[model samples]
Target chain A: MASTIRVRATSNGDITEVQALIQHPMDSGFVKDSKGELIPAHFIQELKFEYNGKDVFVADWGPAVSKDPYVKFSFKGAKKGDDLKISWVDNKGASDTTTAKIS
Target chain B: MTTITGPLATRRLILQGAASVALIGLGNLPFAAQPARAAANDKYPEEAFKQKSEADAIKALYGKTAEPSDKVKLDAPEIAENGGVVPIAVTTTLDKVTSISFFVAENPNALAASYKIPDGTVPSVSNRLKMAKTTNVVAIVEADGKLYSATKEVKVTVGGCGG
Candidate 1:
């Protein structure tokens, strides 16, 4: 599957900043389609960010979140050439994982 | 030309077999079980998500009241032409920040989004949100076991919910 995440990580002195955009529909189940039927809720329920095998950031989301979520965070203990991985699972049991290198 | 069982019995057996196969298929998918496992131990804040009033949603989520803080900065446009997607950004300089949650007082559901900030991570987040009508948007930050918040009113020229 194509990677659904686009990440940019850069280190400024000691703090390494990470910004990511995830592709998702985030259907809230409240919206109705053209047929006037409620769309079943489909959203990312959990998102985890790891830096060199250590958990750095985690998010628990609901259907209320908007489509194509954007997240930005920074942490210490990460240098250039370090590995940053992000994974997320949706309410429908679909998920995606991607890795990026800190610049 | 053999004796046949009842239709209901046969249907039940077929359903059971299908269910077992579906369960096994889900188990085989690596990511299928991930959310289920986390949800088993995590709280969903059902009441909070269902609330319509801001006060009630905050009460359901935090239980305690939140005090206004200047450290919390909620950035959004003073006037949003479109309510379908209003960009919001929150940043705080509070020590030991734990979580940041957003609430739209006028939406069908008050609690819009909630984010958990892990230790050592910067206490900032940005996302687009849907607004049902022109209303106040609140950002609450939890730090050192205390709740602090900031609020901003966004004027929507066009409603997002077909209004």
Candidate 2:
């Protein structure tokens, strides 16, 4: 599967800032189509960020969250060229993982 | 220039006294309790997320009430043109911020999302939220064993939650 996460990481002093944007519909199951039919809930339930294999940050999201979520956070002890990974699992049991390098 | 030293001096002293009281209150907090609580490996409150009411969701998530604070900043549009995608951001200057959570007061499930901020990370997060209707969107910050929050009413032109 193609990567669904786009990330940018940069180092300033000792703190490394990581920003990511995920592609997802994040349906809330409450909206109706033109046919007046309710849409089923489909949204990312869990999103995890890791640094060098260690969990750095995590988010638990529900259907109320907007589609294509964007997250940005910074952590200490990370340097340029380090590895950062983002992974997410949706309500439908689908999941994806993508890696980026700290610039 | 007219000098009003008498009244100004008294006001300054009063403000100083209030600032000290606030400082003392913070100093008396149980700072050690925060790390111990965060270390327990707290899991996501599934029941809270399942709640349809804001009060119940907050109760299940924090097990306590949150006080509104100016220190917590919730940045969102006053009117969301599209309910399907509303951008919301929260940032807090509070020390030792452990987590930040978002809630849509009028959604079918009020709790939208919760983020666990690790130590040494900036206490700021932004996400797109779906608004079922026009309602208050709240941002709660857990810092130093206390929960502080800020709220903003987002007006939605179109309902996002499926009818």
Candidate 3:
């Protein structure tokens, strides 16, 4: 299956900016299906970014996050051509990981 | 050495069964929560996220209250056409920032997200969140062990019932 996470990181001088979009239902359990059954809450609990063997950023998300979440942030010390690793784990213990190069 | 080993064996035997049971019973106690908090780098903050109000969520997450600060900048839309995906962003000038968090006052659960800002990372975050209705959105920045906050009111046209 294709990776659920898509990330783009770019370096400008001393900082690298990162933007990521992940595919997930992010069900908050408040909505009902067509059958009127409540959709169980399913959302990414955590997402992480690592660079140079160190954690650059970590996001802990709750059900209030929008479906198909999108996030943007930046960090220093990573240069162009460096690898920035991104990963996420959902409430059901499902996880995905991918790496992107800082362009 | 032999005398010490004798007492060591005696104590281990005395503690073996009792200790296991005691630890099991102490789940959710301070003793267990301490270690869980110590290892919170990977632990999902379950209690913090489950809080129903904004103040309760902040207290559960940080165990402290935040003061309004000029150093923190919270950006949110004046009117959200779709409550499911309201763009929110926060940036701080405070030094030694350890984390940032968002809370929606009227959401069923107040905490929307929390971000750990490791050293060398910029203290700015942009993300989308679901809002149940028009409410105050607060951004808290934890820096040097102190919490500072900024708030903005966002009007929502359509509630995020499932969004």
Q: Candidates' lDDT values, in order?
A: 0.81, 0.84, 0.90
Score residue B22 of candidate 2 by CA lDDT: 99
Give the Å shift of residue A20 in candidate 3. 0.4
lDDT of 2 by residue, B63-126 (tens): 7779999999999999998987899999888999988899999998999998888877789887
lDDT value, residue A27 of candidate 3 = 95
- In angstroms, give how far residue A36 of model 3 lies from its true place: 1.1
Error of 2 at A47 (Å): 0.2
Q: What is the lDDT of candidate 1?
A: 0.81
State the lDDT of candidate 1 residue by residue for B109-152, as single tens digits. 78887777777788998878878779999999989988899999
Task: Please give me the DockQ of candidate 1 compared with the native complex.
Answer: 0.39
A1-103, model 3: which lDDT tens digit per residue?
Answer: 9999999999997999999999999999899999889999999999999998789999999999999999999999988998999999999999999999999
Model 1 segments beyond 4 Å from truth?
Answer: B1-47, B161-163
Compared with the true structure, what per-residue lDDT tens digits does model 3 show for residues B1-163? Answer: 9999999999999899799889778874543222223113567888788778888788778877899999999999999999999999999999999899999999999989999999899999999999999999999999998899999999999998663
For model 3, the chain A TM-score is: 0.98
Interface DockQ per candidate = 0.39, 0.47, 0.58
- DockQ winner between 1 and 2, please give it: 2
Candidate 2 to truth, TM = 0.81
- What's the best-to-worst order under TM-score? 3, 2, 1
**Model 1 residue B14 lDDT score:** 97
